[model samples]
Target: MEPALDDIWREVHLDGLKPVLPLFPTDALSEQSDESELLPDYAESDMNSAISALSGRHCVKLENLSISFGSVHKQPSWTMDPTALLDVLRQNPSLKTVTLRLPIPAVTVIEELGDLSRLERLEMRWWKDPGDTGTTGDGTTSMELFPSLRNIRSGKLSTFRRILSYMSTHLITWLKITVSSFSETQELFNMIQPCSALKSIHIMPIVPLAPTISDPLDLTLSFQPILKCKAMENFFIHTLNTVPPSDSDLTSLAVAWPKLSTFTWSSLSRYGPQATLEGLKTLSANCRSLRKLDIPIQVPPELPKQTPHAPFCDGVTVDIRQWRVDDAVDIDRFVGYLAPLAPRDGTPWLRLGNVKAGVWIAVGDRLRQCYD
Candidate 1:
């Protein structure tokens, strides 16, 4: 062994210099075990780089694939031809899930998605530059791109409607979309008419960060159509407006979706829509199956002088109050009120404070100072 030391060192050095292996090897690397090592993708690479890696491995079956561009937005040089990506997808017939975060070509990409015959789930985020022509006021209206995208951040309401129209026949069970305008809200209601297969719906504002459009979110009217989907089990809506749904609307929700186990509704503006304690009580009484609640509601300033009663339902596991760190008093009130109402076995969490093991007040104080 001492005489062969030079040869052993040469073999070890040579192994390190070998070319990098592709992601999915056709043959087993070792006979003892079949585990594969995690190979890192080049951080700066684009879709073309990915295609090149898998070019010859057409028979490789990927159960799940995720691709995200490292850059925040795509440059002109980085854009990949949409058809080329489709061509790669065609080769992977066994793909069951795909998640993409890239700037894809227009409407043509949506049609090409049909090529993934075995796909059961898809999540995509289209990157855009504020200066891009496609994002201009006139651009989205002229040509509808991202047909599978049900969510809209900023675009003509008509364009969103057209996009939904294209997806009417797809078998989608979960959906999340953003509505920016009141007119768009109406159109969204119309578009949701055909999606009877929906089991969970999450509605978020299109421009939640900077809302350029000002329209009262008519939640009552917008939500009426969603109630028709009897299969619904979970519903969440975030309205960046100043108007909260009224008690009647809350009652209607409880009546419409009695089977809902989780429900969340929030408002972006501080002065805008908030549910009353009465509305919360009504919600608890009606939605018998509700186990989780994330609502922007104002708790009573003082705990009721009367001894608190058990929550209307078996015991709500989650009651998320949208209290921010700016107001310590509001945070105090929310925790003081809900801690007692929570079931002994249930877990309660505050949006801005921690009430676990009776340390919520201290948590609130710390958060308030941090914000200040």
Candidate 2:
């Protein structure tokens, strides 16, 4: 509709180019081959036309624009030609939010994005390649690409490391990224260690989010670098596999982020060295803003004589079903220490799957009495 409504405020959404089916079957594929046909076909995107339409519309109102060529249902095969939407992007220099579901564009395209100093949010599907950073002979990636970006979502953790290398990103608020390897995650933490203005972070998977790694993920040690972001509010990590944090690890996290509203480690089930009742109590005591806490924890062998605090927030909920409690723990006393799991609506959330449901029922009963 660029022919009719060429205003700066008009939002544009276009379906990107489609992927082509492979001529060769799986059996014909070779691991050693470096053929372009072996690569996933990327959405060339509808930008070819959208760019032509908006090439002359230099309006400051186009704040949100979305262009895609790829889909999760039909995965692509073959490499992408660098982006062709440079002219359209140049015309709308003030675009604040841009979502390009295209493959990694040439850094030249990134460098030439007209004065996007106002760009606040940028989401790219495959901007994961930390492309040719050694473009400068001295191997410095100090390019001022997105100086004013506040929210960014990319496919790779290494890409963020490249972005955050020289960015004075104090205004950054929300960040989402997909990670594939353990070492990549460790290196990503290096970049995130200094940029503390971030509030919410979502660490997702590339596609079909599942447990692909076989090595034991040391979540406790990995969590150390994140503790540097003291302003963290909502944090989530999804790999479906992790080692339960020890009591010390939990305590360190409780002390690190006082404003932690939501914390999640999306694991199917975790075992070994989980937080005890004391660790849960410590978390509730310190993180008064907590609304949701998802972890694997256990009950104490014997109940403490001192009374625990009430639920820190109004509608706090917890899912700690992946746990093993002490056999000698008293149900009556063990129930009181679990006041933090109390939901605001007076009903407890029990996701028990045959791991002592009776004891959990008693725990829920105590939560009701505490919240009431």
Candidate 3:
């Protein structure tokens, strides 16, 4: 499968993942990979040297490993022959999950990796090194690579999208993807539209190659695409780069995925209008099977009018962490509004209560006081 122009594989170095020492320059991390002539994480060694290190590993049988190599200032000397890498993988047939960050055309890498008979999960990222080589459909064909693959956690859109096209979508049940742009988000939804069997998807905003969180995404338009995967249950987004979702966005999400039990999107922007109590009431009315709710919403000032007609989901922990409160708020008023979400009696044995402190701890304290 031919990847898009932007998703080139840069580096996948498995440097034994040894952390650099205290004397390592912290300043190199903040600089973009291209700008940093010699990244602190990479030892100024060549590809043969990296592979030799892997050859000397302590484990005779390997299960999972992540190896990547790339930099903007990559020299002509930073060469890799996938033949050597392929030989190494051939030795370790027990490898079930393999993460590669390499500076080569994905076509060459995937074609070479077709020999790996037992790899089940693949994590691939393009590191933007000078080593990549390909033209349109150059030097590769549609050979079924990673035959046993199921789970895929890709850092680049092209990497995941290309893999999905080759594999049987029905086989994949879980996905943890990091999308860097809105176009990437919408495009990914199109890819998952056919993933009817996908049970859980964890979406993240930070790009693996860069140090910064991507530009803010408006949830209204951005989230509409993935609603096609009706089988989703544990829906989560590490939405640090997103504009705090409006109430409409919240309810639309709730109504779309009725099966969601462990729903969470923590650390929203402190500024902007937050999702309010009324919005949450609508959420409770629509999606009743909630077990853990962890969004930042405005807690009401007084006893919220929880009518007899209101939908209540006891045996749940609404981990609305550290919410913004104004005025002298009575604790009872807060608990009354949140009674529908209180933990059911005898449910503490599960220990599903949130560990986050600040506002939610006090509210969780009230759940035992007023509802229990």
| Local accuracy of candidate 1 as per-residue lDDT tens digits, 1-372 | 232211111100001112432243223323422222322243344346554544334544455555555433333345555655676566666666665556565345444655555666665555333333322122224333333333222223333343443444234467666666655565666566556666777766555544434565567666677677766778877766545666677787778777777887766754543576567677777778777777666666575543555554775654554654444455555555555454444434334433343446555554353334
- The window of 10 residues in a row where model 1 has the poorest summed lDDT is 8-17
Q: Model 2: per-residue lDDT, tens digit, 233-267?
A: 99887665567667787788889999999887666
Each prediction's number of clashing residue pairs: 3, 14, 20
Cα deviation of 365, candidate 2, in Å: 7.1
lDDT of 1 at 369: 39
Better of 1 and 2 by TM-score: 2
Error of 1 at 287 (Å): 2.2
Error of 3 at 311 (Å): 7.3
lDDT of each: 0.53, 0.62, 0.58
Candidate 3 C-alpha RMSD relative to the actual structure: 11.3
What residue runs in model 2 are displaced by over 4 Å at the alpha carbon? Answer: 1-4, 17-47, 54-57, 73-75, 128-142, 207-214, 299-310, 321-372
Model 3, global lDDT:
0.58
The residue pairs that clash in candidate 1, if any, are 242-272, 242-273, 244-273
Indicate the worst ten consecutive residues by lDDT in candidate 3: 132-141
Give the TM-score of each candidate.
0.67, 0.73, 0.65
The C-alpha stretches of model 1 lying farther than 4 A from their native spots are 1-46, 71-78, 127-170, 178-186, 205-214, 300-303, 307-312, 325-340, 344-372
